[model samples]
Target: MAGLAALGAFAQAAPMVTSLGPVRAAVFPRLTGLGRPGHVALTFDDGPDPASTPRFLDALDEAGVRATFFLLGRMVQRAPALARRISDAGHEVALHGWGHRAHIALTPAQTLRDLRQGRDEVASATGRAPYWYRPPYGVATAATFSACRKLGLRPVLWSAWGRDWTATATPESVFHTVARDLRGGGTILLHDSDCTSKPESWRSTLGALPLLLEHCAEQGWKAGPLREHGIADADAEIGS
Candidate 1:
């Protein structure tokens, strides 16, 4: 019975994984509208900080684009106002764990506890439970998926990452990595907060924002939240 249930769930979720290959999967609600042939979604994690988040929001405002923000529960508790600001600015706020810890290393119960607390904290600040949950560092396991299922959240991953967690990564490098790897249904990972030891990681992404937006525009692509797209099996006949 357990195996059958698992198979059913997998079938349901499998369609959410885009065939574009290895790009991160974004759970619904945090996801924006579906992109055309070459469109992509931009997502930022570990945010709601006073230092970098405001500037990031400012840049998004200037570019006239809305992106997904996977926020840490602890950060939301510390900066509820900033969390509110993100929502008010029309960006989707999703969960990125309670403390931004690794899920793969945690027991299933521990993972569930963290996810529950994280969802509650984010909902308290933003007035809605985030529909998406991104594991810190893209770490996932069976326990992680189970916890997500229990909480009614979906797992999202990225197709292209800027490696902005590193201090040595230049803004140009960030741009190059994203622009070169972008494809339809791709989710790009970045960070709004500098939790890393290096301040350059945050600065590099902030610096690259305008250029990245311009590149998207030049490619005739627009940026938005991840929830706008729906997942359905292309091979499954509707009336069959």
Candidate 2:
């Protein structure tokens, strides 16, 4: 019976992982980046892997673009230099939590502690406090917002994702998935590391990025990190 209940809960929460629109509206609509026009924020999560991160960084450098990287604390502990390399490149370093576990699995207290630890790890590695966070799997439970509020982190959900966290994803499919819903002033989600997601998924994302940037260039769109997406410096204030 407990197993059945757990299954039911998961069944209910599964949809929010793919589409956070309705859930975000009730929790915090403004942070969702919906209906905003003219700039797109590129955000990468679950990374700092030596094998893959430098590839994406080189691609971004070649394209002359900077993105937001939501780093996992545990991974940073494993690869601090790679994390610093990300920050050193002028990309935004934000938190994706200490462990890349779903919010539904954590109590409010545990979530707060996770947020604090993740924030500290990034700051210690990058010498700057991360003011933004995107929860694992993009699902936010009741505890998430409270933890973010207390932690001084702003909760952000992507408006477009490449659906690249699968073994089958190709660069073409990833590009189309994001291009279908992408617009100016929206946040685009991709993975630079597969640390907490499907293995080798970062390859598809890396392959798709240049095409996406070129698409933006042709559209006269400005593509960059969150700071350029209009979340004010004041809104990005570091918290305790």
User: TM-scores of all models?
Assistant: 0.82, 0.87
Supply the global lDDT for candidate 2.
Answer: 0.79
In candidate 1 the C-alpha lDDT for residue 13 amounts to 57
List the RMSD of every prediction in angstroms. Answer: 5.8, 5.8
Candidate 1 has a TM-score of 0.82
Q: Among all windows of ten consecutive residues in candidate 2, which has the lowest summed lDDT?
A: 231-240
Residue-by-residue lDDT tens digits, candidate 2, 1-240: 332233234425673644745454333334565433677889898888897999999999998999999999998999999999999999999999999877777778998899999999999999989988888887666567668877788777787889898878999999999998787777888999887667888889998999999888888788988877875432332211
Candidate 2, residue 59: the lDDT equals 96
For the record, the alpha-carbon RMSD of candidate 2 to the native fold, in angstroms, is: 5.8
For model 1, give the 10-residue run with minimal summed lDDT.
Answer: 231-240
The segments of candidate 2 whose C-alpha lies over 4 angstroms from its true place after superposition are 1-17, 20-29, 34-36, 232-240
- lDDT (0 to 1) per candidate: 0.73, 0.79
What lDDT tens digits, residue by residue, belong to model 1 across residues 154-177? 766667678777857888988887
